[model samples]
Target: MLSTNSTAVAEFQRKSAQAQAALEKVRGRGTAGNGATSAMVDAGGRLRDLTFAPTAAKWGDRIPALVLKASRAAEQDAIAQVQKITKPLTDDPRLRQTLAETKSLLSAEEPGKRRPRPKAEESEDAYFRNFSPHDPR
Candidate 1:
């Protein structure tokens, strides 16, 4: 049992270090308005830099929108990079199984599928009361 605990702790530390290293290497940049605006985001999706071209003023009221677009693109790029870096760890069977189990426990319904509401004749309290802690069905 002691060895198992130590091994788990060591694995956690190793993965944590790897994740930190991957994050440190992340650098995402995005541009919008035909290079009129650009944004750079770090691994944590924090804006690191923003710049606008001399003609950016020509965008008028649309300048904010352009900046937002650039920012979003930069964030997406950062997320993609992080995913790439963590692919190996995420692909591990143990991690996948844990994620699957957690998702199942949190949400019984699949994505984009809504559970049907109880009939109008049934009171909301009664519907909830019917749920048993031991039985999820």
Candidate 2:
């Protein structure tokens, strides 16, 4: 029993370290304003660097808007990077099963008692692949 508990703890620690490392390794970049502006961001969309092309001088009053666009792009790029890096963490079937078990143990309600979440509408390709005249939904 003690060995089992210690192993679980070690596994949790290892996963946590992996997540931290993935975040630390993330680097996202974005460009906007017709290549006149560019920015680099880290995990939290924190600005790491910024650059402006010679054409930026011609943009004049448009520089501020270009900067905003570049920053927003960089932030989105960072978010995408983080998602790609950490996807495996949540994709593990064992992790999902463990979470369900933990929830069942901790909650007052009966196991598997939660309401079903609403799913997004399927894409046309998916719908066509499983099409049935009687099944409109």
lDDT of 1 by residue, 1-137 (tens): 44654565567568879888889979899999998999999999999999999989999999999999999999999999999887767666655555566677779778899777777746766878897888977
- Prediction 2 global C-alpha lDDT: 0.80
Candidate 1 residue-wise lDDT at 1: 43
**TM-score winner among the candidates?**
2
The number of the candidate with the highest lDDT is: 1
Error of 1 at 34 (Å): 0.6
Task: Report the error of model 2 at residue 63, Å.
Answer: 0.6
Worst 10 residues of 2 by lDDT: 115-124
In candidate 1, stretches whose alpha carbon ends up further than 4 angstroms from where it belongs are 1-12, 94-137
lDDT of 2 by residue, 17-113 (tens): 8889889977778888789999888998889999999888998998989888998998998999888877777776656666676676688666679
Per-residue error at 46 for model 2, in Å? Answer: 1.3
